[model samples]
Target: MKLTTKGRYAVTAMLDLALHHKGEPVSLAEISERQDISLSYLEQLFAKLRKAGLVVSMRGPGGGYQLCSDPKEIAIADIIAAVDEHVDATRCGGLGDCQDNRRCLTHDLWTDLSNQIRVFLSGITLADMTERADVRQTAARQVKRLEMVADSAR
Candidate 1:
């Protein structure tokens, strides 16, 4: 399946929020900047996420978005679905349209693969990622790079 930037970025942005938010709202701008994602794109994703009850938005100063539940409660598949991302390995989007007016011989194979991917993602949580040392190290490297850039620009 082709996992587009929409799905990848949504996960990246959510992970950033989960890592940075410490009982305070984390602004979309901060997530966009840190994750190197477009602000407008995040806006659209967050809109869907808000509607899906995956996130809660705050207003006024020091306001932004927060996870509606604990990180462990949020599944990767849920985030992907909230953003309307489809994980279909088949060319027909699980519709068996790979062949002209007929189903391809391997239609079921790809369909099963997609379902397995969904299950794999469902089993993963944001909290699970937060516990990964590699994820933390990558984020830390980005933070250090940003700090250096800021210092150099000063």
Candidate 2:
């Protein structure tokens, strides 16, 4: 399945939050700054995430957002689903309408593929990703680049 930017960004932003999470919430603005996502887009995604009960918002000074449960409890599939992303690899969105509004010859194959992709994503959690040295290194490098860009912009 080809994940669109919305799904990709939601996962990336969630990972950023999980990685930086401490005793307090992680703001979307901070995530945007570090991950290079637009503040408005993050806001939209977080709204859906909050509704999905994947995250909780803290309202006050030093408030932003925090995972409603532990990182291990949050699956990558959950993140994608919370943002209304469908991982259908089928051309007809698994509706069997790929061939002139009828079932295509390979509709079942594509549907099975989409299901497998979902299963794979569901098996992965944000905490699992955080344990990867490469994930941390890439995030650090990205943040450093953002800092340099900000410095140059000033």
Considering every candidate listed, which one attains the maximal TM-score? 1
Q: Please, what are the lDDT tens digits per residue for candidate 1 over residues 22-112?
A: 9999999888878899999999999999999999999999999999999999999999999999998998888777899578999999999
TM value for model 2: 0.92
What is the C-alpha local distance difference test score of candidate 2? 0.93
Per-residue alpha-carbon lDDT of candidate 2 for residues 8-114, written as tens digits (9 for 90 to 100): 99999999999887879998999998987899999999999999999999998999999999999999999999999999999988778898899989899999999
Q: Flag regions of model 2 displaced more than 4 Å.
A: 146-154
> Among all windows of ten consecutive residues in candidate 1, which has the lowest summed lDDT?
93-102
Clashes of 2: 0
lDDT of each structure?
0.93, 0.93
How close is every model to the real structure, measured as TM-score?
Answer: 0.95, 0.92
